[model samples]
Target: MEYEMFIKKSSLQQKMLISFLCLIVIPLGVFGYISLSISKQTIEEQTITSNLKTLGLISEKLDIMASDLTAISNIYFSNEDLRKILMQPSVEKTYEERAKKEFLTKMIINFKYAYTWLEYYTSILGLNGFELHTFYDGRVEIDELKKEDWYQEAFRQNGSIIWVSDPSPKLARTVSEEHFVSAVRVLKDFESGAPLGLLMINVNESFLFQQYAEAMKDYDQLMLLDANGTIISTTQKSLLHQNIKDTKYYNQAKNGDRGSFKDEIDGKRMLVTYHNVKNTGWSIIAYTPFDKLFANIYRAELLIIIVFVIVLFLSILVSYFIANRLSVPIKRLYRSMQKVEMGDLSERTDVLGTDEIGELGRKFNRMVSRIEQLHDRVVAEQEMKRRSELQALQSQINTHFLYNTLASIRYMLLTQTAEKVDSVIVALVKLLKRTLTDENEYISVGEEIDNLRNYVYIQKARQDGKLEVEFQIDDRITHAQTLKLLLQPIVENAIFHGIEPKEGTGCISVKGWEEQESLMFEITDNGVGITKLETGGAADITEAILSRGSGMGLRNVNHRIVLHFGEEYGLKVFSQEGEGTKVILKLPKFVKTEELISL
Candidate 1:
């Protein structure tokens, strides 16, 4: 009934449809949405990273150019002849003055030949008012130039080189029309540390950036901005020397060393990438339109959307057909199951195809056939076993013992108190019912010990409470199995042969425990023990053995234990003349539930 209710709650077709929606269709839809959403952002990030690499390459080239110009200035500062000329005393007609001019002119000519990139270079002396250059011949007084900001800036540099994009008045006089960038340093005497002069190396700005500007024209504007947000050089000539201090890009670029972001530039959505030049506080920036970057991504997203719609439509149709195909076979199998449950085992499922469903159908038919055959065989066998068990039960219980128990109960009713009579009768009736019934062939050690206890109660009554019995059974072994009435006989022998015949007070103790997968019961008594035999053995042992009858004796109990469990398990006896006797019983510990026998 419970199984039928579960089948009605969710049929096979509904279950299969739900599985497709959750495991296949829904996952595919979710994956398509996630990929499309992240693809445009990922492309923009990759473009920014590529632009940073290009900026890094440009920065490296500019650094090398600056380093080479500084190295050339260092060469002239170390010249001994140039140092001597700058350190000479100012005299109108000195003998060393004429020769110094000739040497200085040759040094300037040599510099021009060695470095063709240098448009011109000038050296001005601070001590003597004299200036020498590649194109100029005169004394340009340092006192006049020292007042200018560019000159003061160089002087303040303290002999270190400084690159300045703004030219000084003296420089404008030499190349007034051409835009130039200059590296200037205040020269000093190597030995005396006195001020020798100022040296300047100037390069053409347009010539230096011509190639980079041409290459960057295919993209948006590329510019190098200075520390004050001024565009020092750019592909757009109009932007040169323009300060962008008020612009959003300037604020953003100045805050970080290098990064990229999206913002509107003059009503156009632009992706801007910027990086700071090392040691110069200048930034290289590129502005490109966002629409151009995401064009390909938009096209791909459209294609994915169309494909997703087609797949979703086809999935509904396919799931319906697949679920129907499987459910038809499963429905037939369920019907056959219901027939088998109602005892109509001849029902079989018709095989539809050679797929998994067909294979399951074949297995189901075979199982039903096997169950039907086993059912008939089981019924017949159970009837035969029942008769055998009845015959065995009849043989197991002795009628003579029952008659003696009834007669003893009658005498108890006449001579004993009513309370005593009722207790004895109840214990006797319980013992007879347990031994006569064939419900359980094997019983727990504790139950058998309980039945033996009832027998002890009857014996104690006969002896007028002279017999005292002690029971010591381990709790772990009590749940284990033993044959019914196994311990009672050994306990009876302890009382009759060992304790009852003694003159003084006698005590019998029954102990039960487990060892090495075997149950052990020991019955010990302090009574007149067995005497020694005449023929080199225990005395009157055969008579003592004969005293116990066929059903209730140590030998009979031992034989039954050996027959049920093996010959290795039985009884062992130890006795002396007057001290005590101990009988040990051993049997294999069988659990009733795990070792159930049909008989």
Candidate 2:
């Protein structure tokens, strides 16, 4: 059978159940394989890295020990008895004999005591061997006696220490059976800077090999090489002292690289990691049997394959049932959409299953219902907006009438013979307009000034010029926007509540200027002044505007200004009892819409 037919031959319900089972099973299989591989690699790499760090720490501790021995030797070499013995030759026979005997006795006792200290530190640092040597009169001797190439090399290198050298003959007669890898140094006089002798330390090769054996316990083979790529040590002694030119590890270590590779060693297939110690010029190598590292991974892969085959077989049996169940509702919904397209808005699919397809059908039906309701709400909102616009227009028309009346009264006073009659009419016009005009909603500083001028003229006329009105305005701020009739209310309050209630003619001044980016308008009246109102009632206006809502004209002006320009531009009233009243209007400097659009 074709693959597609094979997949579709099962029942819908069975297909769904098989698919869900496979979805869960496949990832588990993949995750097991990946996790195993990564974990094995990480552990192996960390093991090797940790070993390298430990070796580096060991090498550093050895260096410090060598330095300490050198320091002690210098102190002993500088002792007055030893120095005097060395400076006097054997020709001064009697003095030389006595000095040499005393010097030898002192040196032996001091060295033995120093050796105790050295042994303690080396033991703590896990050092394998330590030695001190002295070279005098062209002869090299260690512990008052000695042997071979390391000593010769030390003298040839002009008293400089040889930190690392290959396996060589044992220095002390006591250690004659074994060879050693050694570090050696020379002692020098502190003040004269003259060479004294050599200090040598040798480590047994077998001890290091034992450490390598433990570190690579699971591995098939391991080796260590010196700077020249020659095998210095190995887990198996047969490979020790072997040259790298004869082995694969030699060519590999020459690269100074750390990595894994496949090779045949001792007739067994192996995987190896090679790393170099940059400070000591030694390379550490580890090898494992190829089968051991990957054995579990291969077995897991086989198990996954078996599980996949079993699942695949079961999947074929169930595909048809699952496909049919899933497709049915979708087909029903498609039919409903066709009905909807045909203008049958009431059409909806029957949902019998409790899956995503069922949920989708329910949501589609709800969406259609919401759209119909939203259509009705949109129609109603448009009707409400029409009524609100009409109300706004009527308010604007009423404000226009007040503006015309004030203009007419101003014109009559300017032109007619009955000036006093014209003045009374203008005062009445300004009082009515300031109290009722909605044009104050949004106006410029220039327009607000005109309103205030009409208001002050009316107030002075009412008091029969008992109040002298002074106006000072900055020309620079004239075009800035502010609420119209803002000053008229404050001026009226001052005259009626503060000035007229007293006996004498009073001074009333209105001034406006720009302070930084804000336009500040101040109205000060020094009439009778407001003794009672100045003390605490000055702040009452804001509370009255917010709570009692009595002073509608002042409240309206305050609210409109704040709504347009933010609360920072609202009115503030200040007064001192029996002193004067100051009302400050803080407004933002903003250009008119007509001027901005024209620009």
Candidate 3:
């Protein structure tokens, strides 16, 4: 019934088509776009960052070159021969001319070595320009001493160790044909604190500009500037010496900040990054043409548009076929439900293909099976309820025996046999307690022993010691769990039927022990025992063994034992016509402390 309702409520065709579009087509489209966009941006950013790092390394190499020049100049200024020669008159310079030449030659050799080192370093670093200048007295010298603007500036600064000059023309015999941004420093006399000479080191402007041009290869324009915001070098040399105060990058660099920004340069939109060198106060600028930078993105967008149009058309065609494939199962299920609703219980959906629609078909089948099982269960429960009512009626009839026992106890009390009356009353009370309490059906062997003891005490008092009851209980079996009142009824039967009816002295014994994993309790007696006719015709005996009572003691105990401990653990009877009967109760050892509280 439920299966039919589910099939009626759901449209297999619509759900299958919708889920296919959502789970497959839409996700593929979205994922492709997202992956492409993220990957492109990541690649671009990584490229720009790599270029920035290369530029920084180039700047570091230039700073190192300037430091190297200063170190060489310091060595020259501290040379005792040079200092002595400088302090002497020009005529004395003639007398020590040989020593002076040797000393000067050595100094020149040292300078040559330093220049060679810088040359190799610069070459490897992809840089150029390795010029060294020296100031003597009031003049500067490259290969020969001559006064120059930068040299004069350094001599005037005296104590200043380093200075970066604006872009300047290259001196012929010194740094080849390329112009350079130069660093100048004044060498000081160590003892007299006088200016010895000024040293200048020029870094190749062409090479530096080339790096900037490479960095912005995909851009239209790129420029570099000095501290004064003057364009020192550019890809186009014509832009050199131009003051770019109005430029966004220049204004930012002038303020001693470094960052990238977007702006219009000569009517072209550009993304630019400016960085300032601290020691030189020079700014390295990189500009990327915005249109070129996003060229790939534009191309991708165009491709996506084209592909989307094609996919849209393809989807229209595919959706129709998909809809057809999905609708077949749905239409079949719908018709099946319609048949089921009209009192057809055997209707089933026949769906093929391994997809969501197929899964729905399998689920519908399972639902039908469960509904049939539930109907069967309902009928079985109704039958069980009827049987239970009948059993309750049988239990009501069994209560009369209990009432008769209570009447016997009343008679004994009235007769004033005080001891006998007390014993019977106690026994009757215990029996009633066991019968009425339904808290828990299972109990421990120790509890069963205690119950049997009470029964024995009452029976001994009634027999007046004519019969002696013995118990052989293994201590280990005391903790084993068994049905409550399991052993008491069996003991009662032994005493009343097996022992009490005998003419002479009789003995009844109750023994409990564990064998392997099982607990066994036996009730045995030495008496006239049961007659062949009585044993064979004993319907009550068979009932007791089967856990079905005839309103007798052993039968009820067997019933409760089987109910709690299972059929195998209920009761077993072994008897001989002239000897005693032994009834054995078998149960598994399941001792739970919780059973104590219920008792």
List lDDT for all candidates, in order: 0.73, 0.59, 0.62
Every candidate's CA RMSD: 15.5, 23.8, 19.6
Candidate 2 structure quality by residue, lDDT tens digits, 430-520: 5455545443345678777876676666555545558888889999988787655567667767777678777888888899999978889
Residue pairs clashing in model 1 are: 532-539, 533-538, 533-539
Question: lDDT tens string, model 1, 1-599?
Answer: 99668657987798788777677678887898888778877887788888877777777766666676777788777888777777766665566776777787787777667766544455555456656665666556677776777778877878987766645555655543345667788888777787778887766657547525644843577887766777768778777777898998878977777888878988889988888876556778888787777778888878988887888778878988989887888888888889898879788888646998889899998998999889889878866764564345435445655566677778878898999978888887777777665466678888988888988887776666689999999999988887777777677767777788888668999998889878888888998876643425553243355354542466766666666667688777777678877888888877765563421
lDDT of 1: 0.73
Task: Find the number of clashing residue pairs for candidate 2.
Answer: 12
lDDT of 2 at 485: 54
lDDT score, residue 94, model 3? 55
Model 2 per-residue lDDT at 486: 63
Residue 185 of model 3, lDDT score: 58
Deviation in angstroms for 125 in model 1? Answer: 6.5
* RMSD (CA, angstroms), candidate 3: 19.6
Residue pairs in clash, model 3 = none
Over 4 Å off, model 1? 1-33, 88-106, 112-127, 135-144, 173-177, 214-218, 245-248, 255-257, 298-599
